[model samples]
Target: MKKTFEVSDRLFELYHRVHRLVNESMTEEGVSLARSKFLFFLSKLGPCRSTDIACALNFAPRTVTEAIDGLERDRLVMRKPDPEDRRAKIVSITETGRVVLEAAEHPRKQLLEEIFSALDDEELDALFDIVGKLVDRTDEIRKRKDEAEEAAQIAIAR
Candidate 1:
């Protein structure tokens, strides 16, 4: 139990360390890591509504709105009235956004490469497997929780 806790603690710390490093490097290049995710999504998906970005990114609507506002202010993205729904707006990445995103990606990729280069082939393979297992277990837990909630809702309805 102690070993398990120690391993998880180290993993958590390592995640934050890497995240901080990546964010710092990207920020120097004019795009914070958090904002890059939104740009990446918009670049791929083209124009979509705030609701869609919220759902796809698993972010709260208000959080998405704030991020979009910042991105728009920076000229990284633009929002226009939805043609189909006057009450809602559609957000899309600007050409400038694409250029900035591409530029920022280089440093992010290079930093990750430099960090991962420390691991040899065997370590890389083992780390990949471990991460895959952890992700699978997390997904399994989420599914079970969702099922349990549905069951509880059904019982309450009766």
Candidate 2:
């Protein structure tokens, strides 16, 4: 019998390949994939606490902190005290960061186009639909897990 793989196994392989290609392409911008992620998140979220970035990215606190340190050093992001919380610092993207982000987008677009060029429009549409469904399923799973954790905590407290 011919070896067969589950869709999830094939999807994981595809994820690794795409992630490797993206990281390799991002290096041309003089920023690692991780740093680019932090820059983009700061751009979207505006000034926010470092912990918030860590949570949003689902990255370890140390990882986010180290990336932020490099970003701050490169002047792509700046740290300031949060107005609402004196003890917390917020990170915001700088003008340099905006320029870097804009410069990065064109090449990223080209890379994605090259990667996806093998698929026809119909195939691409089907792939998108499946990916969207997977994302929704993951979100649902996360919600259930969160609710279970919260209920457990409440039960323990009582």
Candidate 3:
């Protein structure tokens, strides 16, 4: 008998393939996924601190520092002392960064549009609905996993 979970397996495969495509496309432009994400975030959110960026990106402070260092070195971003907080610095994208981001936006959107162009409107809607459901389910799973780990630690300590 054939396995029943083939659809799920195929979904996972598609997910990985899409991720690889994005990485490959971005890599050709000489940027990693994390760097691209940080640049995009900075473009959207204006100046933000390293700590806020780390939390928003779900990265460690050290990792954020490394990315920021590279971006600053590349002249894509600048770190200025936060006027409100003397101890902390905020990162701001440079004019060059804005130009790069604007240039990247069209190609990225075009690529994704082409990828999804095969689907009809109804299919596209259904795909989005399914993705939303999956996101909710994943969030619940993460919460449960965290709670389970906490419970296990408590049990071991008692």
Candidate 4:
């Protein structure tokens, strides 16, 4: 008898494959995924502190610093003292960075379009709905985990 597949298993496989493809494709485009994501985030958020970027990306502070250092050396980003927080520095993407980001994103966008082009409008809508539910479920799980941890800590204090 043939084995039935689970949705979670399928989702994990798809996620892994897509992630690997993205990494490989980005490398061929002469940019690391981390750098591309950083540039994209900076573009969206404007100048932000290195710590903020680290928090948003769930990366270590040192790792974020190193990435910013490399971008700074490439002249793709500038580090300036934060106006509101003198001790912290904000990293801002340069015009050159914007150009590079746009170039890198064009191919990625095209690849996504090509991949999804086969799906009819209904299928696309269904996929979106399913993905949204998955996102919500993930968030719920995370919140429950957080609450459990908090409860455990409170019990330990008593």
Candidate 5:
């Protein structure tokens, strides 16, 4: 394997290791990483519909509904009729949810800090720059792939 492949593999393993540690820490505080994402979104975005959460999180409506149901059952979130659309209910984080979310966030942050503290300031800056470039390239490739697929579909239709 090329050095690039080896580096990629190491990065992948490191990511999973870090993620697992963070999840474990958060779980000890009574929240999973997935649950934290929803709580964080609601805490930041204020009240919104399940459909809104689905779009924002790139989850299916059913998945968001199920998650919201669980959160509601736990008294982490609440739903009420939307003022603008009576047919839809808006979801919001309760004070209890906020408290739990904050608690969960602490362990996640602590774990990340412990992991990244291995890197000095200069190394951290370089890593951020490299990661940004990789993300940008990935987005560009995805956009081109999407456009190519769209063009192929158009050609086939014609």
Candidate 6:
């Protein structure tokens, strides 16, 4: 019997393939996939706290810290104490980071275009719409789970 594949299975495989492609494309910049993502986020959001970065990026705090450390070492980002919260630090992209991010934009766009070149405009639109709905639902579920966990912790503390 011929094995059949589900849409989810295909999507999972495609995700990994795209991820690998991106990572490979980024090699010349000496930026890891994770750090590149963080740089993009910082470029979009401007200065932000590490906690915010972790939450927004859905990355662990340690992961964010490590990425920040690497970026800082590369002079791509800088960390400074938050004025309102002494305990928290704010991270901002450096000039070099901005330059790197700008340089990366075209190639990243090309890579994405190449990967999805098989899909025509209508197919791409439909795929994006369906994926957007799935992403929204996933975010909703995650938010509910986080709220429930927080409530449980509060109840326990009380």
**Against the true structure, whose TM-score is highest?**
1
User: Against the true structure, what is each candidate's TM-score?
Assistant: 0.97, 0.86, 0.83, 0.87, 0.92, 0.82
lDDT for position 158 in model 6: 100
Clashing residue pairs for model 3: none
Q: How many Å off is the CA of 104 in candidate 3?
A: 1.1
Of the candidates numbered 3 and 5, which has the greater lDDT value? Answer: 5
TM-score of 6: 0.82
Alpha-carbon runs more than 4 Å astray in model 5: none
In candidate 3, what are the lDDT values of residues 1-158, reduced to their tens digit?
24537878888898788777766766566665567888899999999999999999899999999989999998989999999999999998988877766666666666688889999999999999999998999999999999999999999999
- lDDT: which is higher, 3 or 4? 4
- The lDDT of model 5 is 0.94
Per-residue alpha-carbon lDDT of candidate 6 for residues 12-98, written as tens digits (9 for 90 to 100): 998999988887777555665667889999999999999999999889999889889989999999999999999989999999998
The digit string of per-residue lDDT tens for model 5 on 38-131 reads 9999999999999999999999999999999999999999999999999999999999999999999998988889889999999999999999
Runs in model 1 deviating more than 4 A are none
Evaluate residue 5 in candidate 3 and report its C-alpha lDDT on the 0 to 100 scale.
79
**lDDT (CA) per prediction:** 0.97, 0.86, 0.85, 0.86, 0.94, 0.87
TM-score, cand. 3: 0.83
Looking at model 4, report the run of 10 residues with the lowest lDDT sum. 1-10
| Distance from true location, Cα of 15 in model 5, Å | 1.5
Shift in Å, residue 138, candidate 3: 0.8
Instruction: Write the residue-wise lDDT of candidate 2 on 48-140 in tens digits.
Output: 889999999899998888888888999999999989999989899999998888777677778899989999999999999988988999999
Between candidates 2 and 3, name the one with more favorable TM-score: 2
Candidate 1 lDDT trough over 10 residues, lowest sum:
21-30
